[model samples]
Target chain A: MTLHIAVLVVLLGLFFVLPAYHVGAFSRIMVLAIYAMGYNLLFGYTGLLSLGHAMFFAAGMYGFGLTVNLFGFSVAPAFLTGIIAAAALALIVGYLALRTAGVAFMIVTLMFAQTVYLVILYFGEYTRGDEGFVVQQAQRSFAGIDLTGETERYFAALILFAICFLAVAKLVQMPFGKRLVAIRENEERARMLGYDAAKLKLHALIISGAVSGIAGATYGLLFGYVGASFSTVQYSIFPLLWVLLGGAGTTIGPLIGVIFMFYLIDISSGYTDAYLLIAGVALVLLTLFAPLGLVGTLRKRAFPWLP
Target chain B: MLASLEGAVISAILVLTAMGLSIVFGVMRVVNVAHGEFFMLGAVLAWVVTTTLGGHPVFGFVAALIVVPVLVGCIAAGADRLILKRVNYDPDRTIVATIGMLYIIQQATLMTYGPEARPVEAPFNTRLSLPWFEFGDEGFQMIWPWGLSITSYKLFVIFAAIAVLIALWIVLTRTKIGLIMRATQQDSDTAQAFGVPVGKVYSWVFGLGAGLAALGAVLVVPIQQAHYLMGGDPLLLAFIVVIIGGLGSLPGTVIAALLIGMSDGIISVFFSPTLAKIIATFLVAMVLVFRPQGLLGRAPS
Candidate 1:
């Protein structure tokens, strides 16, 4: 816990010391890291690998974006609506998807996500289809502070990230999180011990979805744009990649993974247009050499008490 | 009627692609997420061959039909040896590796193909009108319909797919390689003990699967334009077909492809294409949730 707080304190300190460009980049990474953290809860701890998490993220995004645009909702209510939308979606999807395990689960989630994406496209008049609508700068202010400003946006993102980070950290150390890990390690054994595996998984998915929704809502609110592109399979894969790279089941790993991937792409795009090629190669290499991921490898090799 | 014909063509292509995926999944127990990329590569390579040949369209098309699959098969085999073998084909790692391959392939194509949707000229295209039979006072006379017609190329696709399926059936059943492949699929450890080269068989199966997808793409490229992004739809549709048909069942795959392809075409006629896709995707997910073994697959022991 102290280590997590120290990490947050250092992040706060970095905002003041770092240059302008990095601070902005750090803000975006922090937001994305929250999404990764949410993904890790179900995937890392619960051992459910979903390929359609973009649906939840987009649920929050569209919920927030649509309510604000169509209904003239204030930021606070719009954000709540986004999170609720995601939670509701998670409830339905989790209930259905949890029926199938392993590869089928992956496929089910992937197809459901595809349906969400298509639905978004079908209602192009309202959602504006592929070309998404921008959240207006005028409506972005909350509590007498404009979120569009760089400093304000950074702080807003930081606050959200810190909250989620602490919650997930605390949750993982709790008995509930331990049970989830138990389920992950051995579902049959966990069930034999009288734990309701289905209900536990469903609850975990909802919480994970809500956290992802929070990130999604905050992302649109802070960055001031919501688009259907964020709902793509590519977007779904991003969290998986981040979680895998950062070390699944680790509290701070998602943040490290997000930052690592962000800079890898950012730095590579400067040299070539085919930056995704570099990412692909990195992924292949990681699977080959670092299957456990950075944090996972660290835990395995040294500092077993790190988590 | 037109929608059914179009669906038949789609089903034909889907049979080849989905069959490829099914075979690989059955034998290797690894889902190649890059399967669609291999299909895209086939279409792209077809374009390259046809354009560069600059001869008769038939000659170019024939050359592509013969050469593209072989080339793609070799590439897939190389990938299997390099990446898949190293990972030991663990299910999760295979997915990630294939996704990485997907990115590499897609990005490379974007860099080379330049993001344009390029069309390949069919070897031959002739519009053939059809007669409608109607009972009249003059007694059963065939009347020419105003709008009922199909191109020679579309009909050819249907025939080509049938020919390919027949040939594939024979290869899988009648040949020594087929026997080996079947043995490996049933029990790789036992087959290996019996002196079957399991590793080599895996590489060949991977190659064959990719080759089949490439062949499908080559055939369809003339009908639909070759584009870097065209693989996504086929991948999703093939996945749906594979799951609905029951994994690894050849006949099931063919039947499911027809069912799905026909519905996709007919649904588009009644509803918006996007709506059709949403419905299909949702229904397929429901099927997997309820009938995880698929429509024809035996329940796992």
Candidate 2:
């Protein structure tokens, strides 16, 4: 318990202080962490690997963008609308995709996400296509308070991240989470045990979709722009990497992985033009040496005391 | 009329890439996400040999078709021995690992080649013209038989792709190594128990897949320029093909590839490219929902 509190304190302190030195990097880390956490709920806990998570993320961004630019909604309302739209999209996609498990599920989700990406890419009129949608001013105000400043947005993101993290943690401990775990471990056995595997998967996917949508909304709001690139297959794959690198089953793993990966990319980009190469090398090394991920390694080494 | 030929040409290219992808997936149960990267690598190497070394483009392409696969195949063999060998039969971990490999290879290519599209001119540019027919304000010109008006290069691509597919079919059906591969794919553990070197077979299978992808790249480079990011478009299409055909069924993959390629080509020609992709993707999702084992894939026993 003391360890958990201490860790949280250290994390929160780092989050608040890091922006002082590098605001952009810090924001990137937070947003990615949020995204990874959302992914963690579906992949790490629920045992459903969704390769097209970017669909929900992009849906949220587009939802928010459309609401703000087209409908003239306020930032808060637009954000809510984005979440709702993402949830709806997730429900539909999940319904069809969750029918298959493992590789098929991964490919199906990826196909859908890529389709969305292509749609956005070719339909230049509505999405502004490849050129992307830009926010003219970052000075989004909520109830007349300027929420556009970096510090304000950063704090807002942090608060939202915390809430999302807590929500996911809670969901994982619930009955549905247990069913998800059962399905992950052995679908046949779970079905024999009388659990509706598809329904459980759907539930988990919806939650996953909602969380990913929130992450996308936060990303758009923070960056003050959104584009088709956000919906690409690569973007969809990032959270999966984060979940894997962090140790999928653990609550803190995704967050830890996100922070580590974001920093790795940020730091490596400065040294070499081949940031992707460095990151890829790191991933290969991690997968080869530490399949269980960094958190798993740490837990094995340091905390033999906990479950 | 010309559009139909263009569609046929594009379909042929897609079929070639998809066939290699399908065979690899069928034999190895490994969804080599890096397959497209191998294709791109072949194109890049071919471009280098032809343009940088001042070699004949055709010879360079042929060299790439032979060499790139051997090189990538060796790397894939290493991947099999060092990485995939460990995660054998664990589909989830394998998928994750392959995705990791995909990113690594993609980035490595980008680092080596830079993120730019380099044009590799085809060795030949012979267009065949037939008797012209008059249309409203335009003359309907026929270039080839069956109302198909396609460039000679495209015709070459079609013939080459068909030849490769037929050759692959023969190899898979007739050869001793092919027999072993079939046995291994059917049941790796059983095959190993029966004295087949499953490890060697796996290495060979990985190499074979990489080689096929490289061959496709050699064939395709003229159509689409050799670019660092060239693999992405084809990779998505290949994935769709693989899913539609069934995960590990080569014939199924071929059929799915043709179906998807033709539909995608036709749709892109008639409607918006975006809508075509959406339709194709919708088909995949529908297939998954209705036939999770795929069009020809058998359910895991």
Stretches of model 1 off by over 4 angstroms after superposition = none
lDDT of 1 by residue, A1-307 (tens): 9989998999899899999999999999999999999999999999999999999999999999999999999999999999999999999999999999988899999999989999999999999989999999988889899999999999999999999999999998998999999999999999999999999999999999999999899989999899999999999999999988999999988999999999999998998788888778877888888987899999999989878
Instruction: Tell me the lDDT of model 2 at B197.
Output: 92
Clashes of each: 0, 0
Query: What are the lDDT figures for the candidates, one per model?
Result: 0.93, 0.77
Looking at the true structure's interface, with contacts defined as alpha carbon pairs within 8 Å between chains A and B, what fraction does model 2 recover? 0.58
Task: Please name the candidate that would achieve the greatest DockQ relative to the true structure.
Answer: 1
DockQ of 1: 0.80
Write model 2 residue lDDT over B82-116, tens digit each, in one string: 77778764677777677777777777877778888
Every model's DockQ = 0.80, 0.57
All candidates' chain B TM-scores are 0.98, 0.89
